[model samples]
Target: MSIWSESTQSRAKEILAKYPEKRSAVMPLLYLAMAEDGWLTIEGMTEVAEWVGITPAQVQSVASFYTMYKREPTGKYLVSLCTSISCMLLGSDDVLHAIEDESGVPHGETDDEGVISVEHAECIGACGGAVACQVNYELIEGLTPEKGRELVRWLKKARPDAVNTDEMQELFGGRRSFDWAIQSDVGAAGPYPAFEPYGTATEDAK
Candidate 1:
């Protein structure tokens, strides 16, 4: 049996049709697999290999190269605190420590309940909003130690089905990277891109 569901299979076909070469579809297909399992599983990789006519090792190589692809199980909310120059200079370190203290887990580890995972990221491309972090890859800017702790506590307590980016920014973020004209309701569920609009199938099934 295939790992992909009926909808995912159809979506995969659509993605493959867009690319001239099947190999070019590897990245998007990998995202699809990650969305299915929350992280890249061996079976999912194997299926992707079959779809793209590549070896499983080759698929693994691609997945390992990108930090966005989670090789292991991650919490529902992946909190990636930026530790790059701009963020570090603006007190990202203190914010990171504060999150660790509140979540009771060090960087690169998940909480006891597996709801939140904390990690130090190099640069999330939000330097304008220094001291930034991404919750499930949704940017939350201008985080202070207090706001960092509050963010984790809120995730643990609420465990909302969807984590709205705009709402989070308004509540916990400050200093925008740029003026935003459009609004989005997309909620990220894990490290990888959520294939569906509202969220991944895993989130939608719930």
Candidate 2:
């Protein structure tokens, strides 16, 4: 009797098939569901659990583990900035300050307009890029003082009065990856699945 939509139910089937154990798909399913609906309601989890043939407990546990599953709806742009050792050493603190100063919102707080949410992250795994921040899961790296400012300026100009953009464009200095964000993995990138070069980010963009 759980009422998941036709599309979500179809995706649930695909996700379940990807895993030998149905339990393993719980997290990704919850993530997809939440991405569609914004927050992980108990009702939604129960519906997804029933679809995946897993206990509600499994669904709940999985949802709780990833920071991406918002218990509460977040801003239009969720900015997760890396504060790890490499980023920290490379002036991520100043970067953090720039973001805070420009956005006028404290870390872990959402702006009243609900346009952006800022939070600290452990690592984004782009150590070679030296410093980075994510806007709605798009990784922008090789941040210089001027580049960062332009990014902020550009974000402030987005329509619906948004402070983030969908395209993510290029860095102010252009693609800095050399092969920029490029890597090889049996003719593909280690972290990239679709085999595109000049693209990377450490985590799930969640």
Candidate 3:
């Protein structure tokens, strides 16, 4: 049986339409599958492969290489703490421990009800915001141990069906549509030639 729903399949068609080459749609399709299922199951990977005319192994290989794609089931909220040099100096370790203590789930694991999952991550590129953390891949900068605990509390009470805060709309909102990413600007915004022909400069020289 197909894991993809009818609506998801329709959205996949739209994403595929964006690229001239079908293979180029693989990443977006993979993200779509992850957003729909919360993790990339073998079935989902296979379906994506079929859509892009690639082998399942190829899809799996690509999926395995990216940290953004989760192989195991994750909670509704994924809390990732960055403990790189910059964040560690600012006490990211304490923040992680506080979350583990408050939620009773260690790193790489989820709570009993699967409300939240905590993990220590490498630099997430928020150096200025020391002790940076991510809830569902959205950076929550300048966090403390207390803040982490508060976040866990909020996530526990958060309803997926309820309206999410502006920062979290993407996660709670159903499957993502890439319609916003397609560029519509057609003006001559750059110095480079927009049309294809023999170079004007070369013709002038001749």
Quantify all predictions' global Cα lDDT against the true fold.
0.84, 0.61, 0.67
Runs with alpha carbons beyond 4 Å of true place in candidate 2: 159-169, 172-178, 181-206
lDDT per residue for candidate 3 within 36-74, as digits (tens), equals: 676677888999999999999999999899887788887
Better of 1 and 2 by TM-score: 1
Ranking by lDDT: 1, 3, 2
- Give the local distance difference test score of model 3: 0.67
Question: Where is model 1 poorest over a 10-residue stretch in terms of lDDT?
Answer: 197-206
Pick the lDDT winner: 1
Superposition TM-score, candidate 3 onto the true structure: 0.75
- Candidate 2's C-alpha lDDT? 0.61
Ranking by TM-score: 1, 3, 2
Give the Cα-based TM-score of candidate 2 against the true structure.
0.74
For each candidate in turn, give its C-alpha RMSD to the true structure in angstroms: 2.5, 6.8, 13.8
TM-score of each: 0.92, 0.74, 0.75
